[model samples]
Target: MLLNLNKMNDVKKTFDTINKIVADWDPLGVGETIAEDEYAGYIPEIIQVMKNDQSLFEYLSQILANELGRGFDSTDMKHVEGLKSICDKIIRAYMDI
Candidate 1:
């Protein structure tokens, strides 16, 4: 449809503008390419965390505890406080902070 094409073109232009801006404005060139081992090591934990119904931090902590041979109760207040720290770390890592 003509309307669909126009909408697509508008979106394409917007994306082009954004790309140009980012190309001009990157402050950090970027970090080291993530190593395969690093990613592989986190795979199981990331998957378990994704599968959890609890908050992401609590979920990640639980996964870590399991990996470290410790029993952690996600519902406990101490773990919940730990979850807050985990949350900060996660958000910071993703630049969502």
Candidate 2:
């Protein structure tokens, strides 16, 4: 359906944005050691997208599952939880909008 396609496209765009942010922060990609300060700068941008796009949570959840499937460790899980917490805070802030 066209609606489903649009949702998928939105999710893909969000994922691409996340990938670009991570790549920009650490040119060597996710496995690289990025400075916490540098990485923190992009969290707002990601949270904005999640606040704007309802499909993003679903996409993010799937990505988290894939990462867990690949044997991601506790640190990765904590990072994911932190992101979800931020998303939750943003959602609550704008729930009436």
Candidate 3:
């Protein structure tokens, strides 16, 4: 159990470091944050997550629409899935390092 806590802490530190670099989709150009090429690779899988969970999709859509001034159009559903895939993969990949 103690080891698991330590492992989680390491993951959180990694997440923080990555966030400091990416800074919410804006490249800080410093850390090992998710880049365009990396994001592209994960899109398909993330889309599957969003498709399987309606609440997650709605939450993401609302955030984009209200916070980012990004409105969903005909392509948004597909785009959301892609983005979700990319982000999920990034999160999973970063959890270890």
Candidate 4:
């Protein structure tokens, strides 16, 4: 049971770290204009994609574009592109756990 507890703790830690990363990105500008947790709803999905070793960039881009209620364009692409680093950060963080 100790091992299971440790795994649970690691998962919680990863979730918290990724949550912060997503909030920092503030895809909806909510951190500055609205609330900090505005993007909290998307974190679980992001984590799932990350854990599954899926295409984080593509998944994030789609989520961002959908939330912004617009078609994926150059500007939007560029904005989301900035978030690509978070993917690496998350991977490193997860590995460390």
Tell me the TM-score of each prediction against the true structure.
0.37, 0.31, 0.39, 0.71
* Number of the top lDDT candidate: 4
Show where candidate 1 strays beyond 4 Å: 1-40, 43-55
**Model 3 / residue 41 / CA error / Å:** 26
lDDT sort, best first: 4, 3, 2, 1
lDDT of 2 by residue, 1-97 (tens): 9999998886555544554444443422444444333344444545556645444555444444564243324357775565455446445544523
- Which regions of candidate 4 fall more than 4 Å away from where they truly are? 32-36, 51-54, 74-77
| Cα-lDDT of candidate 3 | 0.50
List, residue by residue over 1-97, the lDDT tens digit for candidate 3: 9999998897557545444433445422323444534333323433334434454456445545665566655376787675565456445555446
Candidate number with the higher TM-score (2 or 4): 4
lDDT of 1 at 58: 61
The Cα local distance difference test for each model comes to 0.46, 0.49, 0.50, 0.68
Q: Which stretches of candidate 2 lie over 4 Å from their true place?
A: 27-97
Please identify model 3 stretches exceeding 4 Å from their true place: 1-14, 17-24, 27-57, 74-78, 94-97
User: Which residue pairs in candidate 2 collide?
Assistant: none
Least well predicted 10-residue stretch by lDDT in candidate 2: 27-36
lDDT of 1 by residue, 19-94 (tens): 3332332212332342322224443444335333355556556545765444567579986675565555443433
